[model samples]
Target: MTQRTIKVGMLMAKESPDLISLVGYQTSASAVLIGLDRINAENLLPNINFTFTWYFDECQPYKTAGYLTKLILIDKVDVVFGPTCPEWKARKISGGIVL
Candidate 1:
């Protein structure tokens, strides 16, 4: 079977572009990458492909909502996850499922 690349936009409350190797909240961005790496290593889901990208939207509710919209529409991501905070999660009407 052929696998298609899945573009994912990751939104996090504690990520900074300048801090590429930094660790923060729940798990570091690096850890997410490592998790994906492990999945790839196992070849457990060969039919699925993943292309992950990260987004940092801070802790503001309104800004986070807007950022989420942009990631879904403009970035054209297949999914979005992380940066889990109930306040921002409540305001969203669309886009990728949160965790």
Candidate 2:
């Protein structure tokens, strides 16, 4: 196995101070960090160092799409995990075609 740097894009609601006061559910970013640590500690990646680029969607389709575009074009990430909206998923699987 060769050494590789795999980049992953993440989209989530980064709670602002006011937003945190309104709705606090604790974002999943920390979980991803824990998972990454486990993978590295267990040597599960075979000389791979996973990196992540984060974007805040603020639970909006428009913003999610923009973030997705940036992640796809600018970051050139290997994988993206976020924009959980059904519409976002549809666009991804439907080849970005409009109905």
lDDT of each: 0.64, 0.69
Deviation in angstroms for 85 in model 1? 2.0
Q: Which parts of model 2 are misplaced by more than 4 Å?
A: 16-26, 88-99
The most accurate candidate by TM-score is: 2
TM-score of each: 0.67, 0.74
**lDDT value, residue 75 of candidate 1:** 83
Question: Which consecutive 10 residues in model 1 have the weakest lDDT in total?
Answer: 17-26
The candidate that achieves the highest lDDT relative to the unseen native structure: 2
**lDDT of candidate 1 over 8-91, digit per residue (tens):** 877665655443333343466667778878888998668888877665656556666776777777787887774444463534
User: What is the Cα-based lDDT of residue 85 in candidate 2?
Assistant: 51
